[model samples]
Target: MTRNKGADSVQSEASAVNAPRMTDKDFERFSEFIKREFGIKMPPSKKTMLEARLQKRLRALCMNNHAEYCKFLFSPKGLESEITHLIDVVTTNTTDFFREPKHFEMLLSSVLPDLHKRTNRPIKVWSAGCSSGEEPYTLAMVLSEFADKNSAFDFSILATDISREILQRAVNAIYSEDKVEIVPMALKKKYLLKSKDRKKRLVRIAPELRKRVDFRQLNFMEPFPFRDKKDVIFCRNVVIYFDRPTQNRLFNEFCLRLVPGGFLFIGHSESVSGMNLPLRQVAPTVYQRI
Candidate 1:
């Protein structure tokens, strides 16, 4: 067999072209930019993951290297769209219905009952960093069930995420069948509608339940625009991306937005310990504004 030296050379060049050659300086620059803008800490250990994720954006723009992509990202021409694309690529959106089930249990067994007894006003709940609509819809289902029995009770849910793509999905209020598997059977039956097209294998949140949630795109680094305080804030699993200082500042902000005695529910793996915030721990990963 004759050796195809030309083909071998071409293949070698192609592999080299595809491989990421991001420099340490370039990685540091990106790490610093993301931390400053989004408060997401990306240390040297995440260099490979960051490169892998950002490669998609580079390919989409037909950029050749990390330096060129970084230059474009900082240029006037790439300010708006490129920045949003970078954020979407870097931000984590892992969420599901009834995630961290104990928090929901606490809300049902303890928090809502106390709020109902204390106030006749409409309840306001904020599902901060509510990715792809799961958390807020879960809140709505639970609150809806509560409201059905307590005829005078009324409530609204505000769902926010930094990713516009995720916010749109939240607004659409559609989900895969598997995504709703964690929802209690009774609540699922009451609140979810199977899509008419069975092949889609999708479910839609009931119209009434969907109407109760308002989805918005927001970055926690910026100032919040809430005029009225929230009775409950579900920011679970969102702050894991941020560092301690960022988490402290964000928890304080959550405290300010919460009504006195308002509930704050974080993820199972998270805590408010040693933060010196105004919240008192009421249950595992559950806190109340003091």
Candidate 2:
């Protein structure tokens, strides 16, 4: 017996209600823009944030709202460097020091100890999609404690992001108390300097930690521009924006850049199980290059 057409129609209607109201054209524009500017793959759930960010842009430009802005975006001048400015305006970057505590705990308890035992050379770490400097700075602080001033087994951290504004802010290393509140008191005292001025209620990362980290601008989808095999990479949360195929490509590239036995830390919601890479699962959201 054939299924009833009405039943299928009812099922389709239910799916529509659960789905976001974003149109295919709107999603397509946002996807293309994000891919070009930040090497991020756009997930379906990002429709709300993208709409909210770009809606304000539309109002600012005084164009015919999102529809007109979309058309203008496809114009000759729109696809140029203007796209970078667009992403800087719309994408949401939420990060904090030791944001995912487990990853850091793993690093301090297990990963660092092993790396230290193996070699006396300064460890090299890359914080791809470093986003506003928290992850890299956290890496620096942990490595500082772990390495213990031998200076031989010291560490250098390279943190990169696609946003120049965020990069500059990351380099500034100054943060409001609200942002730094979650950091432990001992860590806060060690790695952060509290501002005393009444006008500026902020904390700045200590010079010692800041100097160990090098901040640069990098788009991950492009070729691997920097050369050393990375000992550790914290690329968490960034890839959730990417589609499956893009995620696969990124994992492949990461495998190439990571040293054997190097660690790749991803967001709690991300994994590489089906990516067909040479990485072995170490923990939830953590992988070791095999």
Candidate 3:
């Protein structure tokens, strides 16, 4: 037993010592690869983050060093998997239910009602870059409330992300109490139910709410396939990684996707002042597709 324990300890030490040192070159390669593939620009300052996120992938693949991983990624045969992994690791997805509350309030109080009145058809909302599904689920909860008590304004929530892995998790629609704490109390009662298992103090979204959202893997650089003129599109906290030209193109695409007078919500740090899309600023980080 002692011999086996010592051997395991030595193996662990060896693995730690052989782990890849993420240097400037590796960081540049990651940034450039993402840019070329997705038009997403990751700054060199995110080297530490690159290490942290990619280290998981290396560990999964049982790679001892970044050199071998980099070689594999650069090889023609490995390019497809490498680009998919790049999208999974490089895109930052920090979101929650009802994040930036004021925006949701605007969506609930204004956007849904106006769109419902305008078109006899369903109000379509797209949660672009919907990390792990909280945003779209939250949207469904609000829309459900509106639809139940009020007119039967049809609605569908489309949740999309570049990472299939994350999209799968989003489709699962399970989250710990810690993640759902920011969800308003009323919504908590209306849309979520605690799991019977005590080990997991998490809640599953109510089926009624979950049914309203359709989760899909979508890369923003490509032409969006959905033809439904959207009522509101949420692309929050996502564009800061893109270069100015990419952001300009993204805004143009968003304008094309939105119906006239539909809304576009961006990250608080992101703005379209100089890009000059038909969008008019309605609030900080919010615009109307005019």
* Clash-forming residue pairs, model 1: none
Better candidate number, 2 or 3, judged by lDDT: 3
Q: Which parts of model 3 are misplaced by more than 4 Å?
A: 1-18
| Residue 262 miss distance in model 1 (angstroms) | 0.8
Best by TM-score: 1
- Candidate 3 Cα lDDT to native: 0.84
Q: Model 1, which residues run further than 4 Å from truth? A: 1-17
Q: Per-residue lDDT of 18-72 in model 3, one digit per residue for the tens?
A: 6678878877886787788788877877777777778888887788767678888
Over the stretch 15-118, how does candidate 1's per-residue lDDT look in tens digits? 65777778999999999989988899899999988888887888899988899998888888886768888888889889888887878888988899999999
Residues 7-68, candidate 2, lDDT per residue (tens digit)?
A: 99999788546433447687887787777756675766777767666655565677644667
User: Sorted on TM-score, highest at the top, how do the candidates line up?
Assistant: 1, 3, 2
lDDT of each: 0.89, 0.81, 0.84
Question: What is residue 107's positional error in candidate 3, in angstroms?
Answer: 1.6
Candidate whose lDDT is highest: 1
